[model samples]
Target: MNYLTVLGLSAATLTTISFLPQMVKTWQTKSAKDVSYIMLITFILGVSLWLLYGILRQDIAIVLANAITLVFNLTILWLKIKYGKTRPRKYL
Candidate 1:
């Protein structure tokens, strides 16, 4: 493979690895109250667009990186919804 492709793969690997800790932490801690809904949603949207762009451009690096990142972010979003929810208080 060419150096550029290697570079791209290296970049993709690092970015993907970087996001893994958050996924693991969220899963282990089961606490996502601190995670922002807007940020996660916005980031996911942006990543989705980037994935589409990569597909159009036929760039494997961008496609793979963003696709994995999107899944990670979506998992976090799901964890946030599942763990961050609180039962409403009842008043007698």
Candidate 2:
């Protein structure tokens, strides 16, 4: 509850939750045609590192946001692996 912590939480919430839309869309559509596999892989690695950093530092905001982000990223990565190479129209 200090002002800075509140700001931290807000920032964390926004940045973290921003990944949700992409995850849900990919999950529902099962299409990641436009999403870069390289980007997803790199982003996942970065987030995982941040999650580890958060755990080491005992930072709640970092931990919570990165944990949620990890889930979404993993889902998107899975979808990409499962569907990225196939014909999009076939799925539709």
lDDT of each: 0.89, 0.87
> Model 1, range 1-58, lDDT digits (tens) per residue?
8999999989998988887898888888777767899999999999999999999999
Listed per candidate, the RMSD to the true structure in angstroms reads: 5.0, 1.9
Q: Candidate 2, which segments miss by more than 4 Å at Cα?
A: 89-92
Worst window of 10 by summed lDDT in candidate 2 = 83-92
Clashes (backbone N, CA, C under 3 Å), per candidate, total 0, 0
Candidate 2 global CA lDDT score: 0.87
Q: TM-score of every model?
A: 0.89, 0.87
